[model samples]
Target: AQRVTQPEKLLSVFKGAPVELKCNYSYSGSPELFWYVQYSRQRLQLLLRHISRESIKGFTADLNKGETSFHLKKPFAQEEDSAMYYCALGGRNTGFQKLVFGTGTRLLVSP
Candidate 1:
């Protein structure tokens, strides 16, 4: 079985402050981790993937297999960055791609 856990339900930060959203996972086989964000009244979109090793909108997440974690981080928080962030795990299940998502962490950026 595979699972993703996001301990914090809400994270509040002020503009220009650093932000970190923690995520942990458990899986038997190799896992693919991803970060997804959903803005207010908008559809969910992929923020970054561990395999890509790229940063989007100033957010980045690195897969730490030894620690079984994939934490999202940003140098600075912006008011427009406020949104719902979800950590997802992807792997092959019976020859098909299976994705397991965490409950998610809501980010609130204040001015």
Candidate 2:
């Protein structure tokens, strides 16, 4: 069985402050990890992928295979960055597009 958990239901912070979104998962087999972000009115988009090791919109995430975690982080949070984020896991006998998503963490970036 595969499962993902985002500890915080909401994370509120000021602009320029550092932010961290906690995520933990449990899976028997190898799983592909991803962070998906949805800005104000924008559609949910991929923030980063553990496999790519790339950062998007000032945010980055690293997969800790040993800990079974993939936490999203950013050095400076921006007010415009306020949105909903979901930690997801993919890869099973299922298709690539099929993903299991966390409840989500609401990032409230205040000025």
Steric clash pairs (candidate 1): none
lDDT of 1 by residue, 42-82 (tens): 99999999999998999988899999999999999999999
Candidate 1 lDDT for residue 15 = 100
**lDDT assessment of candidate 2:** 0.91
TM-scores of all predicted structures:
0.96, 0.93
**Local accuracy of candidate 2 as per-residue lDDT tens digits, 13-101:** 99999999999998777889999999888899988999999988888999999999999999999998899999999987336568989
Q: Judged by lDDT, which candidate is best?
A: 1
Best candidate, TM-score: 1
Q: How high is the lDDT of residue 60 in model 1?
A: 88
* Candidate 2 weakest lDDT stretch, 10 residues: 91-100
Give candidate 1 regions above 4 Å deviation. none
Q: Poorest 10 consecutive residues of model 1 by lDDT?
A: 91-100
